[model samples]
Target: MDIKIYVCHHKEGPFFENEFFKPIQVGRAIAKKQLGGMIGDDTGENISEKNDNWCELTAIYWIWKNTNHDFVGINHYRRYLNFAENSQNSTISLDKNIDFLLYCSQNIVNICRSYDIITSPLCKIHQISSPNNRQTAYENYSFNHFESDMKLVFSIIKEKHPEYYEASQISSGLDICFFGNMMLMRRDIFNKYCNFVFSVLFTLENIIDTSKYDYYQRRVYGFIAERLSNIFVLKQQLLGGDKKAYHAGQISLPTFTRTYDFSELNTKLGFVNHPAQTAIEILHGGTVHLVISFDDAYMLHAIACIMSILDRASVRDALTFHVIHDESLGSPNISIIKRIFINAKIHFYDVRNDRFPGLLPRNRPHISKNTYYRLIMQDYLPREVSRIIYSDLDTIFLDDIIQLWNISMDNAILAGCLDEGGLTQSRKLFGKTHNKNYINAGVLLFDIQAAKAKYGNLRFLYAESLAKHVRNITLQDQDLLNISFVDDIIHLPLRWNVGSRIYGNNELDYAYSEADEKIAAENPAVIHFTGENKPWHADSTHPLKSIYLHYQERASQALQHAQR
Candidate 1:
């Protein structure tokens, strides 16, 4: 059987035209009459005069009223069914002039033979719950009086269609529900669904007071219909006699759009928007995990550090980045990082004062409280992530990080390169009894499971306790870590973390010999900008400062390019 799918559009843009797919301009009546010719006047649908309130469902209603094809489907101008691949992670752009629509046209008959309905992947509603403490899809509608309005919908269903009342209740209580109002089904079934849905919605239009709602919330009927679409399918399944089976499939929700911004998409994805906070995409199938902690002051350097890692690393897509930041770091910066490392998965954790209260003193300008975040990695990071490479923002990767990630800790709980100041400075600050091989906290490879077993939940407490004992320690968190994990520290080769001070100043006592310094200088996997002379500073005198400047310049250029 032949399939007919309408690509519902609002404004003028590039749209597809295959044997099966056609673009239909919706809201034709309310759209400016002068721009009608420009907005495909020849192929427009005549819906209600107030099409803005109905949103895209106006196009779905138009298709139901006009189309006579046996197999009918509805997708948005930006969204489409991802029939090219079976994987949920796969997405396609119809505007890219791809052959995916043609492929769908050829194979949809075979697909529909087995499945009765093809719907988009489930959209999850977060933190909203029913009275019984179960998650529900109802909270998303409760923005103004949307939830109260929905109660009227339930009452109507209970009064008019008593058989579907229970299913409607069950559908509202679900955490995951069908959304976007995008679906594919046989024409007869589509007609039955529309007949029942519009009858109830038309009745609601007479009763619900939408005068107080904003222009966006006035699109209440569309939102209500999306929830009701789930109920209709559930009701069919519950009262199964001749009703067809529902098959959940994937659809490509486009990220690149000319009409809307990422904020709209972010809100649709259920991201909580704090002031200047935005969402980052986390892709599936990550093999390597990395974590970093910084404030807004270090965001540029952190981006450069990540850029250097991506530039030098052989396997980029396998990596996942976990960033811990305070409120100072904005969403635009995170979005910039996402655009640069488009394939890699990036997750952001907002650092709160309550999580680690009293970890830092009140008047410490020399060291930031943000550095202490790495100490509590076990608490924030996902339990499945047992191993993570934590690095400071002032570092650059010269070799593949996958090499350092593969290093074996053996019996040790964590691994790090020895501090440039060595055990003598450690003893001077933390006392001889607390000193061993002092490892720099700038770069650390944590075998988290082993660390948890050895220290239990007392790692953070011990670090806090050690900070109390050593009040004069300059390294702050680093000194606390050395004193805490004194016996379990594993020393890595000098090449893993080569500090700039190791080459410039001979006054400080370094643990490595001249030969080790020469090897690290020649072939370093990571170059650490230790001490006060950072490359970004105008007065920096480090020999390898240009390496950082190169990445910093590239990061700037990438941000500029993305904004365009």
Candidate 2:
């Protein structure tokens, strides 16, 4: 009726010595009473003997696929079975099974601790007869290095945990096949079939192969058993015994990115250079979707600014907002803006500490790096919409702003603004990085259907391969768009995006200030505050602050009026 299950967390070898054992101890403590409580013992060690009360054995050890001696697997079989067959209590129920978490990444970790990674998890126990740690890099780093490289999953995880870098994904079989084993798994693949080859053979043999139960064998079985036990525990949990799944580590929920379907939680993230062709299709068709992303803290702020400008119409019905905070410093402020939106009817998605962007290599996650570049070329646009306006959240709207929707018919892809107007010398100081002729990625209107009809996935997706192949990649996104449509692009007026440097000057400031005062009378298409200056804070000196504040006041007023 009431039970508690704790999964094992075994850390192995010198690097992680007994790291996993501590949790097991705790599990045993918590799970010691009656037919319940697995304080720390992993259930894979469970062996059911005919019983009157409940369980024959307290735990079960999962026998992984990599038993070198082959004898250890037998020992595992016999120990569980003998315990199951000969237990004193006939009143106990065999109906209960313990859980273990073995297989995949868990398998890899077990192998690493026992001796070598590849052999322990993959190499069949037969061919080598005797396998020692083949993972020794110093003995043969040159010839053996290739094998170590195959551990792509572990490397990425390590990098992801501590804000390190991913080992980089290659296009070979690994790219298309691997879906991250990110979530914790409870039940292993064992339940699909009832027969265990080793389990059957040992029962008939009268004698257990005692020699097979060494340290290596123990380690190997430890991991395999761990996985199976995890699964069993999960089943029990869902079936209604106790809490079986605890995040092996603290986990954060992912931020809501823009998604095409509204019926379910949006899982994928969309990143493009401005609003490509697909964005237009959705808007024109009058379909609704949400795009969620967080590449930079500024980008998050930018989205807030854009929506603030859009808020004048008090139009919260058309869109929902989702954001994941990647950094700690800006989180409080971003949250304040979200609370304001919630009061006005904008849907505020739950943002928690579990998921992150800082963990990603380019500060971009969701899609692989190469795939993002391809988004620029063609056909890479999401098809639901032929095109949509993609504007960096930085810019503000001085006018009604819906006119851009009117421009959606045939995308000339009106785009402009670059490098904070050369105010930040860093882009150029990086030499080749600066060479790409900055086209601020801050604004873009995409024609999705056109791109699909034309080029295919572009130079953008293959930026790296192109960089290695073309020898020029300093501008990254800027370079790809430049080569793709610099000549073809129909330039939007400078008024849409006024650069920071020129706008910063005192003389020009007075002239634009007065001009803006008059322009405020009529709507300007969109006013982009293209740099560090923003209207959200008291310090933001953007010429359009007067306009942004106009909407903020209106949003508040609209909310009060609606309450009445």
Candidate 3:
């Protein structure tokens, strides 16, 4: 559809033919791409009704969007940019970079999607070519086209919003621009010319209103269209005031390692990730002491979770696992578990120690007189083993837990789950002995080596429960465990011990780790189900469930083989 969008008259020609008029040229060039409206600015002195033109490019955009690529709303206001040399003047800033033009197109694509879908320049649900028949649910997670757009976005952001220069450096996941917004991509496809398309729309709409910039400009966000990195664009006028924004783009964000494949996890029944030894590598470089104890028949699942955590870690060395089971339950195939840990260049040991704090409260006298112990304490672990990782069976791994395993043990005695506070007041009656802000024993990282060095013999092996009556604790293993380490443990990051109970429910800390309205530009390294959302269980909500389902596919094939 041909539409005449009149701009402030150009000296060389009317808006359409004026290449030297930046805003007009940017607008018309974008219009040809069929994305959206162009920015309008004119600088000339004759001062007639029409001659004044949309000069100075000063007025800010309020709200704008249409069904698809077309903009149905009319321009709201026109005024001169404050810096305009004269009220009636014409100035232009244009670049000949084709990549910059396509970078604009990327922004346009995202902006068009933000508006009503029916009016977008590109068709919805078109076949986005991928390497395979099935496509990733999250398509906008990488960038072969990043370097090109990075140059453009960084350059423009440097010119307009210098405060964000530091943040842009840490923008690790902003690869494809928008999260799950597009389809598959290749390295060379990024250079294509969709640039000026998005900029014109951004110029006429709200762009990014960053922390560093707002402090200086005394401006509110307006005329924003999502950039490829999903950051909104701003006019040159909106910038220039912030000191923190100064040369900020000069400081970049952490670069992405390998992209996480959430798409693989979203659709599957059960999938298996490659065997990674990330946990082992992180703890003491390859040595970790671990203990696993589950009551009443849940060993296979626990074994699976531990192996999965180990496999995902780059370091799978110097770790030990003690299985404290009263009876022999069905076992998982050794070959399968071995295959899972094929590359693990680590040592594994199994122990059958069953001593726990409830029965023999000798080493630690902190257990509540009313608390019944379901889990064995650190004393139950082998004498040689120090700093053990305790894991529950239901939990699974999304990334290397070793990064968690390797946490510095400077001053902490024990490590466990941070009390979620739902049942906060339960332990207050016990005073200092029972304690507040106690730990959850579901996952524990301890320093047995340090304990051994501190105490002459094993001081923990001789502690006893303080009560004449056993308190009926709400969480079986968690309560006593917490009371034991209330003053001793180090709180692990939420990413490492993330549980299913808080998946959609609890308030997020560092808050970004929880489910968010903003789509992740990239996938998480690991997602754990410490509570109920086990991959095999019916109530799973992990975005990467499909990834585990693929493993189920392999398991199914293996089951069929065994039957044959």
Per-model clash counts, in order, read 0, 88, 85
lDDT of 3 by residue, 1-564 (tens): 211112221222212212211223212221223212344321232112221212212211111121121221111112111112121122222232222222222332333233221110111211122212221212221121123333545566566555645444434232322221111111111111013323433432344323443221212111112232223211211333221100000001121122335454353313334443422334363565655554324434544566566556565555455554433322444334444445543232322344343353322233232222223344445555666776655556666666667788667877655544323323222321233345555566777666556543442422422242123233444544455444566765544554443433332122222232112213333344544456776667655555455445554554445435
lDDT of 3 at 233: 19
Question: Model 2 over residues 1-564: C-alpha lDDT tens digits?
Answer: 111121222222111112221122212333433222212233444322211111111222232321112112111110111112222111121211222211112322332233210101111111011122132211221121222222432243244322211212211211111111112222232221113312322232223332443322222222222222322333334443343332221111121111223121111111112232222232455533222334433434444454544543223344333332224325454555555455432222223342221221242232223213223323222445454555545555443334344443345543443343321222222221222233455555556566545655543333433443232233344444554554345544434554433333321111123344233223334555544455667898554455556555554554344345
> Candidate 3 deviates by what RMSD?
20.9
Cα error, residue 315 of model 1, in Å, equals 1.2
- lDDT value for candidate 2? 0.32
Predictions in order: lDDT: 0.70, 0.32, 0.36
Residue 94 in candidate 3, Cα distance off native in Å = 59
- Candidate 1 lDDT over 1-564, as tens digits, reads 768777777765566767667777777766764233223323444454657888777777777776688888777766776554353324343334455566545556666786666677665653211122223677545532357779999988998878778888888777877677778888888898888788888889999988977655688898888888888888775654355654444444333322323244224322133232122232222367899987667867887899878766666776889987776677887777778778778998876754563445423464577787787767788889888889998998877777777777877877899887775455444432324488888888887787888778856556566656444455667766776777888988888898876646433455666677767766677889988778999999766777788788877887788667
lDDT: which is higher, 2 or 3? 3
TM-score of each: 0.48, 0.33, 0.40
Model 1, stretches more than 4 Å misplaced?
1-286, 353-358, 362-366, 434-436
Report the error of model 1 at residue 156, Å: 99
Displacement of residue 563 (Cα, Å) in model 3 is 8.7
